[model samples]
Target: MRIGVIGGGAIGLLLASLLKQTGYSPVLYVRTEAQKNEINEKGILYLPGEITSYVYAEHIKDLSQMDIYFICVKQHDICSVNSRLSGLSGTVIYLQNGMGHVDMLHNMTEEQTIVLGTCEHGAKKRDQRTVIHTGKGKINLALYNGNAALLTRYKEVLNDKRFPVEQVADWGIMLIDKLMINIVINPITALFQVKNGELLTNTHLHKLAKVVCSEACAVLEVNEQQQWKRITYIIEQTKENDSSMKEDIALGRQSEVEGILGYVLKKTSHQSSVIHFLYLSIKALEEKRG
Candidate 1:
């Protein structure tokens, strides 16, 4: 099946590589002509051993030909291309960190199918043409509001043991579950400039992670103690990996703090000083970096 992957960031490249490795010719939708030319020429390198796989990269001008489109851009960055994707046919799978993009799905044409999912896989962009698979995790997806046939079609194209795909009934809970992980790890790691595991090692940062997670749990109406265990579990699993927000800070790019924390803060009935502080700090970092 022909597929389209939007965003040239780590996850996009990883998805493109996985699909290419599985014998599907997936087109990568990138922002620049240079990226397009580079992927077309040298191909995307999936690293551990720097193995290269070729996939076509196309400009976003035409998404009509794709049978399915995977929106892999950051939650905040999705807006830049939102209008372009509005009328496009086929199933649109959105892979984003927090709940911020949920409202956008409401704006989709009735014909446009929405599949919401989160990537558990950890990937880092080593360079313009290379992405390293830091952690292997399955994808959990559910239909927001669409025909079941579309979900089945995407599952057929993407499901595999290496990159297994599972269907969940409630997309809201699935995303919030991911948000729990992101709200804890992303800001703490980004603020302290550490890897995912370091949070567990440092007592101060570890406490901070708990504070944020606790506040988020209260706001999201999730069990605090239970979600804390899940957060710790994630830290154990991805200890060596870098949080996406940390990478974004290092790269001098805007983060999804707004989507991750901003969204949660809005849901909160009470004030969380620590979460608010972290949120403002990340926004300051984003502005300063810019």
Candidate 2:
């Protein structure tokens, strides 16, 4: 099967490279001509310093044709990109952070299949056309079509040795859990301009993180896992790399706090919810920076 990648960011490139290894044809589209030139020269380059094998492929600047489209843009940019890729009738896999943005994309194009995906794998752009593999994790998929076979077919693209995928019902709720994972950690790291591991030493802040995590669980319906469960691994991962939000804030760009934290408050209605604080605090923090 052929796949069209709508972004050349770390996650988008990684997914394209992985699909290339799995015997599927993939094309990567970027927003800029500079990135397009850089990627075409480097092809599908991945530094798998921490992981096993990586697949490599070339990027296409001009859109040709495709069977599937993977929308890997930031949560805020999905609307604009979907507007451009309106002709493709293929499935669009959203490898974005947080939840609830899918509905906005659906409004843009109804004929296309919008697949929701969460990547546990950590990737950071080292430079134009270069991305470093900071960590490894499975990708969970939620497809719009009710057909389990389509889910299975999507999984086949990532079913290889390096990147296994899991399919689940209620992809929106699944993304809620992923949003919780990003919210507490990404913003704190960005605001502090510190690595996650370094922030863990601050007991008060660490406790605050747990508090937000608890609020997110309540909002997203994720049962509490444990103190040293999945979070511990992330704490260690944060030691080496700054978070995505950290990178965004360091570069003076806006954060996805709305998609990550604000999504919870918006969905919960804040009528009788503790997560209302998260929304207020994050907004206040962003406003102060302004």
Top-scoring candidate (TM-score): 1
Once model 1 is optimally superposed onto the true structure by TM-score, how far is the C-alpha of residue 178 displaced, in angstroms? 0.3
Candidate 2 clashing pairs, residues 3+ apart or interchain: none
TM-score, every prediction: 0.96, 0.83
lDDT of 1 by residue, 1-290 (tens): 77899999999999999888877889999888888899999999998877788998887775555678889999877777678876667778899998899876667777667889999999998877899999899889999877988797678667887668988889988998899999999998998899999889999888888888878887788999888999899999999988999989988988999889889878865564788889899999999999
Q: Tell me the TM-score of model 1.
A: 0.96
* Candidate 2: stretches off by over 4 Å: 21-23, 48-62, 108-111, 225-229, 268-290
Task: Put down candidate 2 lDDT per residue, 89-140, tens digits, no spaces.
Answer: 6666778887757667646455456678888888887676666777777788
Deviating ranges (above 4 Å) for candidate 1: none
Candidate lDDT scores, in order, read 0.87, 0.69
